[model samples]
Target: MNHAIDSITDGTTYRTGNPEATWRHMRAHAPVHWHEPGLFPGFWSLTRYDEVKAVLRDAETFSSASGILLRPLAQGEDPGSDRTLALSAPARHSALRGAIAQWFAPRNLRLLGEHLDGVAKAVVGDALAAGHVDFVTDVAAGLPVEVVCAFLDIPVADRPDIVAWTTDAFCAGSAEERSLAHLQILDYFGELAEERRARPGDDLVSVLARVRFQGALLPMEDVVLNCDNLLVGGTENVRLAMSGGMLALLEHPAQWAALREDFAHTAPTAVDEILRWTSSATHVMRRATRDVVLGGRQVRAGDRVVCWLASANRDAAHFPDPDTFDVRRTPNRHLALGAGPHYCVGTQLAKLEITAVLREFFTQVGEVAPAGTPERLESIVVNGLRSLPLHLTPRTG
Candidate 1:
């Protein structure tokens, strides 16, 4: 138990130790265990489904403005706090989300869906042509960035740099590297935001540039920060979910066969189950605004509360045989995209991208299997595969 608790703050533990086993131990023994100070700071670790969901739901009591990671922060506050959508208070968060909501609305997503179908087809076709490829880089990594960059009207040439920066920002080994990556992204978007302001276009950046909240244009810093947030959020989880989901399918052949047999009928449920199985976002942190009792533990005001979404998604009390990767899982109320006010704004877009790739694979792929070992990312924040070498056989009529 102490080992598990200690591992909660160590990113390497996610790669070396069986994280599911650790979470299982916590769920069964200490659903709301307090993590003692180590790499970052001591915080309450919430693993059970109900408790995790409760914390996410009560945004008033548990705030996001302070910070949302296990990493140490300057003065215990995120620099983007109260400004960026992901780190803002309720009122500001709502306003910021509303400003860009149209971009991810049903109509926009439907249009993007049509575009993604073509992107997925091309991406999958290329993989099948290669015969052997790293699925993470070749297949899973391409679609989300395509969708996001296209939606934002980012020039195709600049996307590679954007992807590189985003990867470093989220998965870099050192704080300096991560901070530098974030600064680079901010600087890039800051320049783009200015261009969008000069000559507005029908894109996310333009929307951010021109949007007025309370009859005043958004600050430049806010625009860039939100752009950074959307881009990172748009690319990271969807890619991870796709990679992890593909791994799950390969591991569970019967489930893959069942999905292939009736993809249209099963895809919706399959996407949800994949999201649950991957739980790519891993955990989200919130600051307790007031002292609250959680799982028989008294959490103090200003205390950091970490809700383990990955653990919650695997709790047997919520989902029967939670460890099993069932594509057809129904009644799956997963907190993968999160819950309540801070729910992922790009939920519809993510599903469309995932479904598009799976549909394309089903259409073009015949036999698919691992070519080499799959390498998992060693990050406490992101549950992702860094690489997955795969061999693909084209479908035969």
Candidate 2:
């Protein structure tokens, strides 16, 4: 526990670099060890797969109302102020998820299939046309934004601005930058919400604008906040999954060739493996509601517990040869998209997006290799590449 605490306080141990070794060490030695980083409140780390899953499932004991981020809340900032599906308590979270569940139903997602197929074709075609491109911007980031925008009924002209605001809000930004971006996003959504309210349409915004809770239309703030959540969650997870998936494929050519040869059969499994290997949305925190014993350690009431999804996905106890990237790995119940009640509502859409990307890659691109080194996002919150330079060869057929 002392060594674990020392490693965590070093800061680099969690934020940057490959922390798998660090997590592997912690999982073996201190599955539920406490650390006092001094920069913020002391908290416990849950590195083992079972322990992390337990915390996620027992949200009644480990509440998310304290906020999911490990950073301390600013003075006077109400925990519930920014409550969306991810941060809300059980009842409220259920209500919020229920309101939008139909939008992401399998039938609705299937309706978008042709549209998403067109988007994927265009994204892949454009990247190939460019010959050498930043895959992150040129390919990975394009489809999800378009898909979400189409679903939300956002105007085409507004997408670049929305993407900028969302990227700043979710990735890395100074406090003022994030504050300004947040205000801009809210202002845009506020105006859009009013328009949707006045003239309802067959879109997510209209659906949210009309959703009622307790015999009354849901509040505008909740509508806009959840819209923001959908954008951030939908955009970031899929984008990183595809970008990181491409990197993984390039790094393992045999797996890439295997996928390319039998894309129809392997794409789904490949998508799941990519999700496991990337494991973006690195860690989410919860506060202990009362004193409890976890992993043979006493956790005090009101203590913050950080669960590393990235680490859990790589756990050897659960995954066979966890380090190896096997696209056909079966029985893969990885927690990349999370677990239990708060499991990603966007799972179906995400799978579709990644699957499309892979299938399109095999169908269109003959060969893709790294043009230069990919840059890692410096933040610990999301495990993804900041940029990926790739040389592409289009398929002749």
Candidate 3:
């Protein structure tokens, strides 16, 4: 059967196409539909909540060793496929994730929150003081990179280039540009890893440089690749989520008022709702390790399967009024950060960043209105805003 949507593999389709409508139609008619090869490889698309959750949970059945994005790998292989955390097999993935998990753990976040609160105040205050600002670049993009760089202990002098390289690595216009950016990041981290080896600090790169896996220190290649992983993942997800959440609030005035009225009480649920509404990490791909029947369709061994997290977050069967932007949404078990073992390592950090900024916005800003057209990123992998201009009015006594 012909799907109503344009090719999901094409980046331009995400920039211009109406994917939400198509995802809705597919959820009802074809939850486990297959797309013939087009711009990328052929793959099974899962749109429903249950199906997507199940695939993410059973990583042994649906492996991440093939790579996560929909992009075609060179010669059908990724060099970091089973070595890096995001693309590793379950056994090694556990060890790799455990090495740096302490930094993102609850105790660490509690200490980190104090600093992030201050950062949030400064970031939001600057935007409010500006009167009118591009929320995407001026407000949303600043905090996540700062937090991530702090974890990596990146020097203040080097951050500008790091931020630019990260943007190119994930959202560049061409494949060559993205690859070049990746190489630059890997090289930068490689040099940093060498320094950390000689004189380890308390930062994440130092931990990676010193940590052992399988009774041996991790290889320099894994150290550098994981650093690239942390940088890209840490920066992109929260940046897009913040921008999308702000746009959602601007569009829904009543919800905004409700949040601003009692931010302390409302912030927790609001952050989750924002995550669900934004669904920044759009989809994750896995390769089937065994033939299995899913959603009344047979998936063969080695076939690629793409689970649309954005679509699952909006599946009507799980979420009541799935499309509505409600801030106080409870029992919201959205798959925005994913599910099961491969759940986002930076889940707590993402929440803290969103909550920090929103809290300051609610307390300090009396009004926020869209000032211009919002430009979205042209990528199927990330639901992101390139620019969101907004007019802000600071609260006055």
Model 2, position 30: C-alpha lDDT score: 83
Residues 1-397, candidate 2, lDDT per residue (tens digit)? 3654445434355446548877888888888988864655678988889999999999899888758767743343333343677887888777777978888899999999999988999999999999999887779888898889999989989999987886676444466787788789889998999899989998989988887756777788877877877887898888888999999988998998898889889888899999999998888889899999999999999898999898899899999999999999998999988888888998999999988877788889987778998877766577788789999999886
Give TM-scores for every candidate, taking all chains together and pairing residue i with residue i: 0.95, 0.92, 0.94
Compose the digit string of candidate 1's lDDT tens values, residues 300-352: 99889999999999999989999888999989999999998999889988998
Clashing pairs in 3: none
Error of 3 at 114 (Å): 1.1
lDDT of each: 0.88, 0.83, 0.88
RMSD of each candidate relative to the true structure: 2.0, 2.4, 1.9
What does candidate 3 score in Cα RMSD to the true structure?
Answer: 1.9
Q: Model 1: which residue pairs collide?
A: none
TM-score of 3: 0.94
Off by over 4 Å in 2: 1-16, 73-82, 167-182
lDDT of each residue in 1-397, candidate 3, tens digit only: 2646545556666777877888898899989998887766789999999999999999999999869878764356766787788898888888888888899999999998889999899999999989999887788877888899999999999998898887677657688998899899999999999999899999999998987877998889888988888888888899899989989988898998898888889889999999999999999999999999999999999999999999999999999999998999988999999997889999999999999998888878887788989988888889878788899999888
